[model samples]
Target: MSRVRLLFLSLVFLVAGSVQADVVNKNVDTAVDISTQLVKIAHKVTVENVGKTPVKSLIFGVPAHIKERLSFISAKVGEHQLRLSETKVDNQEGGFWKLELRSDITAGRTLPLSIDLVLGRGLIPHPSQITQKEKQLVLFEGNAYYFSPYLTEKQTLTVNLGTSSVESFARVQPVSQSDTKITYGPYEKVAPFKEERLNIHYENNSPFLTITKLERVIEVSHWGNIAVEETIDMEHQGATLKGPFSRYEYQRETQSGIASVKSFRTALPASAVDVYYRDDIGNISTSHMRVLSDSVELELRPRFPLFGGWKTHYTLGYNVPSYEYLFNQGDQFVLKMRLMDHVVDDMYVEELTTKIILPEGCHSIELTAPYSVKRLKDTLHQTYLDTKGRPVVSVSKSNLVENHIDDFELRYTFAKVLMFQEPLLVIFAFFALFLLVIIYVRLDFSITDEEENSRVEREQKDK
Candidate 1:
């Protein structure tokens, strides 16, 4: 071979090698602030080919466990497609992708890709089937993907690639970790816990699931036997339960299941006398109630087995004996009670509402709450011939979760005499008007002396 030809062939081989080489890069951004229950995440990826030959197709992979928490997936550049493929060794599912160039060209170009993350407990639907018959109250929802209770806050989330050339950019920090608490970043770090951290795998079987906490407070009045009710709702925000679930599998798991992403139990206040729990279709027979002298506890089991992505609703009510709440405290009647229990340990409030009802004759009302209230309004509610209608106060707050419950308080006072003062005022006003008309008639002088004489003469002549 000629020397020139040999040199040209060697050069061509070297160029071809560069176009076929594989390159991968990754970057991650995360924000954690429990005060709002929202966590934001962004991920960027880049891939290139360094080999000499033009590559027709290339596949990029992601963790198999991430399928459940991914709210959405799309490519930043190139007409690429994502698919779920089974790994041959474990038969477990993994994310697969295929990318093709619009037009084949020389080797040295890079492909940039991006994916966004909105992670938390899961999604909760509005006007949910669970609360169709009752009012809807939502307290907090978090957005974080792949939350592992077992993971120490210090352990950084690390994404791995087989090749060393693949680069990554990630920013992670600790929030809180202790015996009674476990939290993540955008905040200060805390100590570790003594109890085992719970672990939840990313299983994409459903669309949404919610974690809710409800509390109902009833105040008893001796004279009127009044009952006051309040409720709070909180949900888990992250991934949802996907696909149609198998009843057989659900039942089997119920008997021996140790881990669940959707089941929760609620405890009622001790003073509750009669309790009822139901969803859209009506009464759910699965619930059981136990009444103790000091308090009552009700166990509620949803009609359909609640799993991820599925929803259920329940309403609870109990009667209070009269005179328990109507008594006067230093010439002013005081009404107070705690409305809810078991707010998630780490959850904060996005919104809160409190309604207070005052008895008749109660006036000149004064009120206060332990937490900050964004808005307050007073309205009249007429019931049972209340002459001096009852006062109803409504309060609303935002960015609140479970930890702020202890700071909640509501107080109000009204005049005791106004209860009957309004009725008495109405009655006296009517009688006063009647007496004034009678007095005016008696004071009028109708006939003068001359007019009377003329009338008498006319009468005598006619006779």
Candidate 2:
């Protein structure tokens, strides 16, 4: 792998060096935490412009083999998100990303950057096969240092393992090492296109969970509620259970770590209420809910404990006061919410879709996200009393990570005149119904009792 194989397992970041240093990478601190199913790597760095020219962009590289598992590649300058572009990796199977710094970095100015990456293939069973009775020891391999096209004045790498039963480690000269962690030091003036090898085997038997698909729909009702619904397709991608699982044996074997999913929890806004959870089969009863300080927590249990190579599908929904996500900017309506605010930890999402349904008569709908979307569609959706249908905006993407939780802003022109349209239509409908009933009751459609009696008497006299 070239210097920057930090993402997709094959991110060949090849940046040509300049004779004179125009941009200086002062310090880079990379932390790789392997405690969860998905690997979380965070890079905090300080960059400065040393030369007379301004720097426009920087290249980031990632691994190639597991590109499908990688997601939520994002950067931040303080609280603001930095814009980036996707690029094809040269001679590498991974992904290459270029972050554009629109402002010219003047000679002496400095910039602080926070980069976060998620690796879907972080922890896999090393042998790729494990028996029911044996302890799982998985091999984790990666570059010892951050691969960069540019030289760094200082750099560091820290590896955090899941448990202490780690052995058969292959390592280079690291300043410090431990049973559950390793550190490679504060190296000085590093050359580009250099690779450091890391191969270690550790024992971890947690359920390797991945969400194959997630669909979240947000509906805004000016009348009262902000309704949110989510449909999920979840899978346990960990080591397959070899034989028929014995519950009695599982209960008896407490010491051995087994990979299975018993339950999961999620957080909702503080004001959320009327929570509902269900699956394709029916309502899931093995769930609980409660209210915390500023949020509601929902603990959900699947129909059964999920073993490796098994899957479950479910849906959940709740409602909150509209005042929470909607605000008024004079005549315009501004709605703010996350694409996906709550999810399981170490999550690997294969696909994510977010749909926002606005009021019936909203016009000039403007929707924005922090990053680009794989697909976006604007259409009309018919609902109760909506004559013209509500405006629907759907955003979909693939290869999602939990950290993709960014606030999405939607602005639309909502006239006060249209706010009462549905209510008025409903009231008119009821009045029409009552009028029909009154008219039917008063109209003389048949002969009265006296007429019937006179007709009977005439028929008897004629006989």
Candidate 3:
């Protein structure tokens, strides 16, 4: 009986293998943008089911070398987006994402997909260290083919260097180099899990500002105001500083610190008011703000220039009307706000924790995030006039990119009468104090009554 059961299981595994092998990549065209600190890759893939069975999903893979740096990945079919989930790929060693297609691909049918991937810490500083006056050079190592689980029939890879000064790149045959772009291949018939070293050495001077940690707090008020504050710890993740720093040379030389970061513009909501930026030392006046039609551009300059490997910390806060983000129906309330906002262009946040402090007396709270996050334990926050304290909802996520700038919905139940609780408490306290004052002044505190004492004094004087 044991031998018969083993044979049946083996047959089932073989049949599943054949079904998975039916899906193949008809063509994959990849475009890699290496213009900034982040590597952005877009793949236009056409897949086909060659066997008699319909294909229900497709598998995408990243090389093991770059797997840990993967920050964001998304897929779309025309205007609609597809769902993706992480799964284990048997016999493979790398990161894999399984994308579920809207409709199954029938035998001999093809389906097109658009996949975008963003990777942080992808580029390497070739020299690893640089002086204040030296221009920065970096190296990019990647695969020449679209790393996937299925066999690809035809594919081409394009790399945009963003600068005409090209040091060198990989040549994997049928390669052509234009001014700032490199074309790799129209390669034919590639096997699964194949990797060819594609390296590019070039000059990139983009700001490598990385927010090491961010704590965002959103305080909701039932009195028509919402307050937001963000505490940010930032560091320059570019090349290391080579030698002693000279403030004189940096100020005198026009070409000094090309790779150093002087300032970066942060975009806030147009409705943001009373915006302020400060560090531990106090208000930082080196910044400027310009209110645009749609956003308020705040140019933040630290106390000093940020050299490679340098670090800084600061706090930014602003206020917005509650009506813009808070909505209510009877006793139920909802708050829709961005989980994270634009810190900078192509920003990378290593750790992010967002806390939403709802009004007191709120209950049955729930949160809806655009992506998966680690929901922390609910806590109570005590502020002025709070009786039982306000409910605080916190969620954390790591390895975040600017793609995470999306809205989160927080729903809770709040009684309409609770809005007047604080005001009524204040009013009654004042009224009770005035009543005590009236009794204290009008009544005699001594052992005798004032009117009776006056009458006895007059009788004694007349006698």
Candidate 4:
């Protein structure tokens, strides 16, 4: 073949691929929440199924570099969880995750999906550093479209910023910049395998919060109470202070609740009581609990303000009536509760450990999570009067996003007979101990025989 002919053929093939790659993005309602630590994005997208056979899966491309730090929290079609797998887009080749539908979408039908995306290390500080008093500026970059191997038709992008004062942003022809948000393109028939870059530098003085480690313990008691406790080691992942922090300046800013993590708040189930907050230095007195009609709001202040690159560790706990979370279905007991419940805002957890401790003598256990779990193990836990010890189900995961929180279903069987086993054993043990004491006192040795004979004579005369 001639060189000119070969080049012309390659060009023709590329044009054909681009022309066929477009997918109708019927409508996309995108929400970006950048007010808190992590930048959370959600898309309620409706797309047309173009293939002749039923389309069972969708291939969506993501920035491969940030894919590791990104949390693909939930992808739902209607009300069911969508299964995801790594695959290539057949029509347009790219690295993408295939979202498998629970039910196939017939050709020429529309499939609506809700996807949750969290960027873990989303905010990059602009100056590569900052001073203690200087406000933090974050540089964030993202593709205008939801990086799909297929080109989008009539897609719109809406972005939310951490601060209303957006210092700088990249300008695109079809994009409009607002105070705290930017919206780009409802363009029709966009070519495939293309990227329209979007960049923003915004004023976000908030502490980029991350939980280094989180340990949550859920204790299920057949005795009418469910207790939950979570230990958290939180760190400010924002720009680090160049020098030693100025206490005076930080106090002024922190006292005003500006650019400092002096306190944090989260909600608890209204029935939750016996609330407690503590750190390594014992109980934190600067915490408050407000009981609302629907839920209890807990606000806890750490020992000191958390600045950039600073860390603090604490634990919060509460108790709920067992009837609220535990349900009895014939011979089996089921527990429905949030795995870690809630942490601070826009939270990113590096490592999280959740342990469900069932009552003593529980066996035949089953554990299920709505989200992905890294490691799961079953073991025996020993406590007071625990003869055979209680059963424990421990599950650990990493890179947890706040909105990714979901309920964990745990089902187990606890025999009614085992409920009384511990009490009976305790009674038997005490009774045997009492008998041994009596037997020891009754034994006679040497001089004790005279006293026994005298007592016997007195008893016989009285009779």
Best by TM-score: 3
Sort order, TM-score high to low: 3, 2, 4, 1
lDDT of 1 by residue, 164-269 (tens): 2211112223433433223343221111111212221111222123334343344434356656453444343332334455566656654321112333344445
lDDT tens digits, residues 191-283, model 3?
677899899999998998899999999999988999999999999888988998889999999889989998999999999999999999999
What TM-score fits each model? 0.43, 0.85, 0.91, 0.85
Clashes per candidate (backbone, < 3 Å): 60, 12, 0, 0
Supply the TM-score for candidate 2: 0.85
Task: Give each prediction's root-mean-square deviation over alpha carbons.
Answer: 20.0, 5.1, 6.1, 6.4
Off by over 4 Å in 1: 1-226, 230-238, 253-263, 291-295, 320-327, 343-350, 407-463
How would you encode candidate 2's per-residue C-alpha lDDT over 1-463 as one tens digit per residue? 3222222121223333422235556798988888777788899988766656777777666655435556667788888878877875445456668787756667777788899888877677765655556566677777676665555667888888767787666656655777777788877665544566678788877668788999999999988799999999999887766767676766678743366778887888889888899998888889989999988988889987777778999999989899878998766998999888676766778889999999888888888786778547688899888888998999998776777777988989989888889889999999999999999999989889999999999999999
Residue 307 CA displacement from its true place in model 1, Å: 2.6
Model 4, runs deviating above 4 Å: 1-23, 26-31, 49-54, 77-81, 89-95, 102-109, 253-257, 440-463
Instruction: Identify the superior model by lDDT, candidate 1 or candidate 4.
Output: 4
Global lDDT of each model?
0.41, 0.76, 0.89, 0.75
377 Cα displacement, candidate 3 (Å): 0.6
Clashing pairs in 3: none
* TM-score of model 3 (CA atoms): 0.91
